[model samples]
Target: MQIDLQNSTLSSASLQKSQEARKILESRSGSGHDFLGWLQLPEEQSARVQEYLKIAADLQKLDAVVMVGIGGSYLGFKCLYESLKPAVGTPAGPEILFAGHSLDGDYHRQLLEYLEDRDFGVVVISKSGTTTEPAIAFRLLWSLLEKKHGKDAAKRVCAITDGKKGTLRQSADDLGFHSAIIADDVGGRFSVLSPVGLIPAAIAGIDIYSLLQGAMEMCDHLRNDKSDENPAVQYSAYRNGLYEEGRKIEILVYYQHAFQYLAEWWKQLFGESEGKDGRGIFPASAGFTTDLHSLGQWIQDSERTIFQTILDVEDAKSPVLQNQKNDGDGLNYLAGKTVHDVNRVALQATRQAHADGGVPSLRMKIPTIEEFQMGRLFYFFEYACGVSAYALGVNPFDQPGVEAYKKSMFKMLGKPGHA
Candidate 1:
């Protein structure tokens, strides 16, 4: 992976700030430092790979597996599954479905109906098991599983939550379900490298070992290399520099459709980590060639308060040739070119055009969308988000503001203590 910042100019102060922030992160002395468990996960969790693989093998015997969670629990695994799944054919493992991310009645109703006939497993993720959405979804799904499979239902469910105690943990023990732990130091947004994300990805047939290896390598690199050359440091410095210059919004641009959920995961990571204390750059995402038609005009002509960071995949893997034809479709001006060639040109052209329109940008070149590179990508952003948020003088791990709505909702529902 390579980060090109030709269009982004970082000041010396910003660079120095990034260095300090890296120190703070490395020393584990920063605010919310208790949540720094993710820094060691790549190495620490490596030992559990075989265990997760064995569990995945069991789950794959089913027709499908439903992953139930919200926020970090849902996004990280979904991002990996969607981005790495085969583009055109069925996945090698069981089909993976998602729930507990929303409260839509129609969607859950249809999901239940769809699952009525298929043999499936459930992986419910929640540290507290009291997060309204997933709790409700899991209750309904578990009831259905019991009604459908009787005493065997417990064998088809896995619970990932606090190891020692939690509602989910107690349920897992009482029901004799397979279980995994969410360590005390890892927050939801940062729990991807843990079993929270890896288990589901493994169940879906992703290369979990390579993924962890990539993150491990990145972790080692960041620890040893503390210079400006470090991608995480440079990324943090550049974005923070832009933020200091009144660029209050950061747009993460990707040319491929598979990266949509990856962007969503990123948004939540940065938005929750940094968007506090009346600070933080608003995180936004756009897909190229697709959003160019709709949002391009605004990005081009509107206020220059947004900076872009583009995720550029250097290769499109399987290339499709634009076969030469003579149907007078623009006179076949260009023929025998691969579709990726056109996409590459579009990426370059858009970057140049946007830069010319006063949008300073940074480009992160990903070698390919394989598991190793994706692991590196995930760690890169996560580490950078930590440094960046610290530089912004905010806690990178806690999302205190997130409780406001939950409190209001619980009160409205007259949920005992809240009422």
Candidate 2:
């Protein structure tokens, strides 16, 4: 959990504001031990989740697993898996697959073809009984599982849903699937701590408790760390100040694809929290030198309405380019410079470019990206989003828009038109 914040820029007064904001976010979170106060929950949420995790862990003994979820569901756990890599928790963690991302029939058919006899299982993550991607994929995958594990194979199914009710919960219950967990009092996007995220990582064999411990620790740090000396508070204050100054969109641009999930994690944290009533920065992500080819022109010269937070890492484990066999098209001038060097230049160069363009740019430099530090980063963003949203007078813990879409889709799909 040792994170290098040396390259992070913050001033003393900004630290003081973050402290005030932290207190405000803590108040909104209320007294739920594990679940942040976003939605209503049953008392059995924690109890149910633990049991389901064991089964998810059991499935890791298989050849592979398919996670049926999208958005926050895929984003958070996918992040944990990619960052943690082969070290995901249990001794039996299996190879993992993520499907249902697109509705393309050929893509789904391709996944099924590759996984036909692979001895894989599915973990459907939807807090409610319905969500188009995961829900449909769940039925499709469940049928596949039923063929593999048998009709009584429901015994092998695991879920993360409401403890009392919901389509997924009721289905798991009716099917006698004894191993699913419920995500209570929290919305899908914010359910990273709850089973919406945990089970997939558990199946991947990730150290989820460690992840939660990291989150809780950062929560305490942000809430209690108070001052410019405290990195979370300092940035929260600075970002909020910019928001007040009319920076309506928070652009989180990064230089690495590995860090792409970091943006996914941030988008939900910021969007779900701050997007309320009429205010909050629209949390968006783009790649460094890459997106610059696409979005940079606009961000630099267009109507500037963003405060860019660049996630810069000083060191990364990347393959170095060698000039041992340099074929020249004037490319020999760049011969000795490694690709990592190129990325390093891009990181610093982009910051300068944005700043010179009159955008209030900020950079968060991580010495490196590893699980322990990524754990630190995830917790940091989650707590900061919570603090920032509360300061902006919104609940940073739910996704109303997501549920609205599902309700409408369910009704339409339930009727004959699409049914």
Best by lDDT: 1
In the range 1-419, model 1's lDDT, one tens digit per residue, is: 88898887889999999999999999999999989999999999999999999888889999989999999999999999889987788877788998999999999999999999999999999999989999999999999999999999999999999999889999999999999999999999999999999999999889999999999999999888978998898999999999999999999999988999999999999999999999999999999989999999999989999999999998876555554555566724456667787898999999999999999999999989989988998898899999999999999999999999999999999999997
Q: State candidate 2's TM-score.
A: 0.81
For model 2, the superposed segments whose C-alpha errors exceed 4 Å read: 1-18, 28-53, 84-93, 100-106, 174-180, 209-213, 321-338, 403-419
lDDT of 2 by residue, 256-360 (tens): 777777687778778876777777788888987789889989888877678788777777666666564546555666667778788888877777777788777
Instruction: Report every candidate's CA lDDT.
Output: 0.93, 0.68
Clashes of 2: 9
Off by over 4 Å in 1: 320-327
For model 1 the TM-score comes to 0.98
Task: Please state every model's RMSD to the true fold in angstroms.
Answer: 1.1, 4.9
